[model samples]
Target: MGLGLFRMFNCFSSKPREIPIILGSETPPRPKQRQRKEELGGGGESKIGGILGRPYVDINTMYEMKKELGRGQSGVTYLCIERSTGREYACKTIARGKLVRKEEIEDVRREIMILQHLSGQPNIVEFRGAYEDRQNVHVVMELCSGGELFDRIIDKGTYSEREAARLMRQIVTVVHVCHFMGVIHRDLKPENFLLASKGSLAPLKATDFGVSVFIEQESQSHMNPIHRRRRQTEANKACQHTVQQNQRRPRRKALTDINELYRLERELGRGQFGVTYLCTEKATGRQYACKSIARRKVTRKNEMDDVKREIMILQHLTGQPNIVEFKGAYEDRQHVHLVMELCRGGELFDRIIARGSYSEREAASICRQIVNVVHVCHFMGVMHRDLKPENFLLVSRDHNAPLKATDFGLSVFIEEDKVYKEIVGSAYYVAPEVLKRNYGKEIDVWSAGVILYILLSGVPPFWGETEKQIFDAILEGKLDLESAPWPSISAAAKDLIRKMLAYEPKKRITASAALEHPWMKEGGEASDKPIDNAVLSRMKQFRAMNKMKKLALKVIAQNLSEEEIKGLKQMFNNMDTDRSGTITFEELKSGLSRLGSKLSETEIRQLMDAADVDKNGTIDYYEFITATMHRHKLEKEENLYKAFQYFDKDSSGYITRDELRHALTEYQMGDEATIDEVIDDVDTDKDGKINYEEFVAMMRKGTLDNEGVIGKERTR
Candidate 1:
């Protein structure tokens, strides 16, 4: 009977006099919506909703307006029945177009943004989505069929202390989580709360965010200082633009043929859906990576669906600091082009390897950044699903640079308490619950725990000679804090790892909660110490494993579930070329070379020998995957250095104005004044040239692409 039930009263002493009220009080009839200002071409209403200039529709396609739910000054709410689900939802229709005030339009936009921001919260009314057309905007949300808190209260007349107390607690808890997420519910009343279903045990949800606001306030309390600083900066910026503000958005050009707009320098890497390349924009001569996806090659409907899903996800996640910025996407006859931020510093694995010996402090630093990204994703109800060293990218080569999470192909939107049955993600990093086919977003936490274990001990807690054995170890989730590394590592680090790697999903530490763990605290005293030889030796064991054994593990892991092997099958088929269900050495070599891997004869032979598991001349699909899947992150790091070398024409360890001009000449950036301007923006030490670190920061796209901030990194 806690506050989650949304009860109205606590005790007889504190109970208020109930004002008699009917549940569905209809309002006095008003005139119909001022003549339909503009009707879409397809008839009375749009078929679907569209944002900006996208295609839109009227509610009729999927929903039938049954009756009026409620009304406000500028909008009316109706009970809408979805055609497919046959479920009732509250649809709010706001009159827009020429008759609406600009402020009202912005207010509606803000409310929609807030709903989208916290979409899947259990105690918040679910925002299905919004649709817009020429005349009115339609917002679809979960209909609380159980009706209002006030209606229930007035009907019951009064309630006992237990009932009222339980209701109050639920409302307060909802508000607490909202405030924690930066939203301030300006208007809080019993009328705003509703029951999820008809019953005393049902949960209470707070709806109507039209008056709620996201407040930008600086933090002075206990939290991650780094995050606090970011919030403080946001507050300061908000203050600067307290009144009217206008900003021009960048112009994005559409191109059907990618070759006409950009020059492919080299293949970056390939994923299940597409191969990415390092390319230069023909007009600007600026380096960017374009992912080329073959339309015909895509087999499954989900893979095809993922293309649009990934694009939409990237577009929404663009402006976040720890999310790879989306440049834009273009499509032609055969392929789709996804232009994105080119992170030259490479993956987190490469950064760790480059350091050779890493500090616990440094690992914590990277973990903190990763945790920040996880928090952001969770706030938006997004689950990355895959969290591994390879998925995280260092923003720059600088010591204090941030980490960004990329690759949303495997990511999905999840609501609270819902479990996903699909067993996907890399075997080494997957949670035990994932294998069980019953898991929620906490699966991401277990994956992160594996990553943290590798970071601190340089080896995973769950691993074996075979995939089944590895699965056994992960299921056991047994931690050996007394092992070679634990004797040298701190108790705090061991404790946090244990908590995160907890066998039970409920006990596992959440990404948000983990940020406050002792190990992540300022002087919470984990090791600031050096590399322990025992840990290093164990790490070496991982690297020193025979190629054949690793290949065996990869092959077995890929076949765990049917879904896991779908992408591999497609890739294998594509590589087979002759549709023979197997690939020969020549096919392998050609494919590898096109992907930008320079292999000598000796190396190529060694690779062919490793994956020819049956001692056969040609490799089958499973063997092919096992061979190609064993890619090292170091290759990506090598590409980053090649990019730096391209900009450092003289190999002088720094880039000069001439080098910059030469690199960016196509965009009319070769002018002496423009070259100087670019250099001055990134020249941190008041130096006339840009070093590798400064160059990296300058190259980071999106919010951090600000010239003034890059110049101030070390100068101030």
Candidate 2:
């Protein structure tokens, strides 16, 4: 045995007296020539020392045990505070009664030995000491407050490929280091890996070694108390046999013509580079979705790589519980046809919208499936950078149909130690770290978190009028957990959301950890209580309302009493900042931040543009007041009549197309196309003109306004 082997068995016998373990500087005495055989071969009982057979030492005399932190299958972990230094640590108490078999007792000794051997290494939790008494065995170690890997996985949002790969790299490092140090960790999983602290970029620490063993012990059957040598050999042989069988199996040749196997039907959907069509297999009549990528559209080399990578990833991820099954891939002169499972249940949001009265439980169920996709993808060594509601589909029209993830166009293989900088993903679902260009797989969790927020509240947590505004909101806006529906939402749900949406990638919850969250877990803390109807209204459409409704709201805002508009006026004055009687771009940004606003700078600019009725670059008091007025205020009968009068210039009880055009042109809010769209959206009776009732209904009811409505009033 070398110096490393000596360091592993430094513990002394408990026969005489217990010796203190000095972590940093302890060096065992060198073995004499005569005693070297006994130490290296390890045949006698003294060879193992007092690993579990230690004389009773009262652990309570040194450490004060507090509340129970967690309970596992083997032991209960408590928050242990050292009496002398008042330093906190975790104490796992394993009852002596549980060690019924001799093998169990020996395994415990090996675990303690391995932990001591691997101590002082980065990413492995620091072991303080192990103590034994008559009733139980106590193991003390570093307190990891950042929570479990599985906890954050289901708890939070989506992740980018780079972020997921970063997390995976950390996990792989722990395994690599363990193997290098002559120990094999048999129980390495997400739950075993924990963050050292609660900080975003906290180091991941391997906290368990119960089933770990030294390589020498595994190789030598006589030295191994469990006699695992034969078992290990059999396992290796079985793996090799499986590999040989797979190699001997006949492989299918690539199909050049998809038309020969399947008959293409109606087009299901179309994208920028490809078209998805419903196809029927000629032999079996099984329906599948065939996505044909036009070769011409993939002009760039990177774009072509993206297409090929997507096909490969889909094939690689086939048979996953939450991923769509890839049927086959075909190539022709014109296009590349990739076939997969056809999900008849449609998109995730579509099901939610159709459900009518949604609840936290249902949202949790959906989010669990979404995060599972992230977990599965990351585990398979693929990073799905683009994760949004549209990418998910239900397997069938059944109410309890299983959800599946589709589309891998932006996905990539997780390369070790690689720093990914390319910005990818939908604007609303992208993580902040992706924007910073140093992200990892955690970006998927962040995106999933955004989807959760939308699922719970019926709209995205970060709302904006444009892509730039959405990115700004992602970078700067605070997550809103106090708005309308949020007050009624469960605390557990909000806590998970906070962990998922953590600003730092290192701090953000992993997909496996998120899945273990209380709210995200199956039949866990998520409530069955119906969410507010307002959330459903907002989710249906987040864009600007019709131009007519906006003009009406503004008219109503102008007529408000002094008391009603007092707060609005003060807010406008405060935003003006320099007492300039108008709010400039810089002033508006600063003011919003001061007011605890979640709006980004770009969103503020959109608000400023919407409020500035005179088309000025800044927002004046009147414009600000009008733009900030709540929708309920526009519902008052007097206010509605006044606004209708403003548009119904002729007082003929109906506003004709000319009147609408004139009002819109006077405000410079629309042209021919906008006027037509507004009429097309708000004109319920199809009279091509608006009546008083119609105007009031437009003001009161929720409308999917696609054009020219002012900001804040339409979105918030």
Best by lDDT: 2
lDDT of each: 0.58, 0.66
Q: How accurate is candidate 1 locally (lDDT)?
A: 0.58
TM-scores, all candidates, are 0.47, 0.46
TM-score of 1: 0.47
Every model: Cα RMSD to truth: 25.0, 24.9
Residue 470 in candidate 2 has what lDDT?
A: 63
lDDT, model 1, position 177:
56
Model 2 compared with the native: what TM-score?
A: 0.46
The clash count of every prediction, one per candidate, is 14, 40
For residues 74-165, write the lDDT of model 1, one tens digit per residue. 77899998774587899998877532543444456556656754544447887765656667788888888888887877877878999988
Candidate 2, residues 1-716: lDDT per residue as tens digits? 11111121112111111111111111111111122211000111111112243223456866899999999776899999977568899999988788775456555655665665565455888776676666778888899988997676566576679867878888887787676655667777788888877786777889988767655432443334245433443212211212133233221212256676679999886544567899997746889999887877555444454565565567555555688977666667788787789999987766766676888998898899898889766665456887887689999999999899987767765543545666657667889877666766778889899889887787778766434556678889589999878899999999999998998887888888888999989989999988887776566554224456667767887788887776777777777778988887678778867866555433454455555665545667666766666556657899889989999899999988898889998876665655755665566799988888888877777543233221111110
State the local distance difference test value for candidate 2: 0.66
